[model samples]
Target: MNRKDKIALERYRKRLEFARSSGEVNAFETKAEQKARIERAKKDYAYMCKEYFPHYATSEPADCHLKAAKQTMKNPTIKKFDEMPRGFGKSVMDDILIPFWLWINDQAHYMVLVTVSKDRASELLEDLRAEFEGNPKIIHDFGEQHGHGQWEKGFFITKSGFVAKALGAGQSVRGLRVKSRRPDYIVVDDLETKELIKNPKRQDEYVKWIERDLIPTMDGDIRRFVYANNRFAPVMIQTKLQEKHPEWVVNHIKAYDPVTYKPTWHQKYHDNYYRELEKDIGTLALEAEYLQNPQVEGYYFKPEHIQYGKMPKLNQFKIIIGTWDVAYAGSATSDYNAIDVKGLHDKNFWVIDTFVKRCKMVTAVSYMCDFQKRLPKTVVVHWRFEAQFWNDEVERVIRETERQYGIKLNILKIQVPKIKKMDRILTLHPYYQNGRIFYNEKLKSHNDTQVGIAQLLSIEPNYKTNDDYPDTQQTGIALLEPYNTQNDGLNYRQGKMRPKNERI
Candidate 1:
């Protein structure tokens, strides 16, 4: 045997050894049983996957998403894009499970996996290589897969005319074919990166390559195209494809409900898992990666507009007011209970404290009571919330909170004018633009403070982004306009009329 044959023999030996020892192959099934099982699995993809990969399909019964994805792959003529979130077993599903299914079903003659880089794709291809080289159950069912003993890292050909190749993004796609067949199954996994999304020219070029070059390499009428990646950026390849091919099947499954935090794949993951993950990575990252709803950096309220400094003493301010934006449903799908405590001094609006969260009205009310208790009773803070949100439930919540805390809250209602919400939000544009708004430098790293700022910067004219934090912020600052001058004492009230000067 040649040196290449010797190497192939050695690789196969090690792979088979691992597979047998690792419970990846069945040692008990007779030939008839294996044949019957494979034949039954030829139609039941999920069963086939579970039986073949008991360790991977360990959710007792697999999640609906896994079953659904398998059904999608079963279609020979499928053209689909899946914006699957992280931790959803995307790599394993596309690289190993689907490829094996296609090869066993004779649906693919030549398969191609195009990832961010050649090396990464080659590394991913190893999983499939191990399955083909060693899986005893597969070998018993369909015979040996190592065809012609030509197993290379870049591409591999099995004994049963199955061909699999790996390539990098923007790689040359001039000649991709088997002896007489073109690629029948193509998987494009994570071709966009953070830096790549920032460069529109490169993004455009990559899309062109996929459309004008790579995809056209498929020759058969019966084929499948799966682009599996989260749409974490505005100009990513997956986003472009989704816009261009609205007719294609799109499975944009998120890890959990962004509002309720209920796990989508509950069989595999739990609610606390997503909550803990969000805490570790922060809300913005959770939205971008696991939710696939990335927030673009502020266009109107740029980062430069945000200023932070050491705040003056609470008593030194001309006026300190608190604004509350009440929300009925305390989920991200609805408005949050956004409250911003603002103090106007020297014509600058300083964010002293913030309470932004998606919780029940009682929780926000309790927070107000707690904050009131923490402050010096000598320094009074007049609080106001929109009159439109005032209802029996709101009143009951306030009364209950007051009773529970055994203290009265100095709060009132502010009639929101009949103007557009966005119009009202734009009231703070001048302050932000003129560098008259300052965040408490000490509280800059606070989660509530950061979330409020993120929402402020993400505001757009007509787009429905989260505006709860900024809504309350503008309301508080706008209310403190008359108090910009330091003539009023610390006792100035919200609706207290100014004492008219009398002729002496």
Candidate 2:
């Protein structure tokens, strides 16, 4: 309110404005100046290291990778270095490169550190804390601050002006945006797990989260994304990014012989494990785990390999036939049968629809009656019941439904011979392999069907999953064998009458 107080306030405001306008007020220089400063700083720092910790610094002087990592930190363009494998100075690079770079360049604003899990992220922060505290030179370069866990924060008030903060990767990391300053640098240390990377859906989610949530918060111009992890799958962040964004520079630091560049250690370990693994499991198991290749095992069938045939439209293949693999009484040991419907064509078979039920026979018959109402008048949909324990029940329901609806439902009883599992698999292999079989893309049993087919096709009989439905599928294919041929002519004897005593 006084004139003297107002004058003092006005002077203070003018000085603040002057400081803001004059870029020279702070030592933060241009990119070219910063580069020159970084080079000089690195040379002085390396010399200081040699003088202070001669033994510790020169232990791995012969290693080109270690020297390269140190050099890479000096260059502004190379923001990340993906150090692969264990005992290859990964932790050392993290401890040294980031802190050293921040210490030397005062203009560096914020540093965001990330790891795969919360526990590992915490551990990395602790390691960084120790390095900063133990090294007095680091303290001199960067001012020290103490806090606990997530609350922990530090800064380096260099002549230029730079600050670094250690953080983890999780939902907790979402708080990185709260900072007044944007990150000039980011160091992501092994932010992927074996299970998370392998799964396609999980990998997609993580990648989107990183791009949407993490990347936007940083200073895009000076930002860095450092990552290191054991090779997982083709769907991993590194692999996916390299494919999706080809312009981004990516380097793979692998361990191999200098001359031959062969994976000696990796191969040796794989060879030893595979020798034992092959004896218990098979070659597919070895290839999947050790070689990191896709393996089709314990799968009901290989759906990826299923061929979609070029055939006439659904209206043309009007003659439909439904076959039921039935089970009733809700017994734990019972098979949940599938009623597979095929639309017979002049040349190829069209799997128009299917009905799978594991309940009372009356319930199943009612379902079939409902299905018949929706079908075309020209479409003569025939029902084939497995002439076994529940044949009489199916017959009774079919007769009642036909009488009620006035639709002449032709029910045929076919005898499914009792055969070994391997024999049944072998019988169905030729039909599938020769491309005589086709299934709807919308089939819920698509995966199961493929796995079943794979089991049948394997040289050694290895039926691991539930064999009931797949086995029933095999029997149905066998009964239809007489109907399958290159010639359009149907076998009169095969199509004449259904077999009796259908026993599995």
TM-score winner among the candidates?
1
85-112 per-residue lDDT for model 1 (tens digits): 8878777788777777766777767889
**CA lDDT of every candidate:** 0.78, 0.51
Backbone clashes in model 1, listed as residue pairs: 147-159
Model 1 is weakest, by summed lDDT over 10 consecutive residues, at 490-499
**How close is each model in CA RMSD to the real structure?**
6.1, 22.3
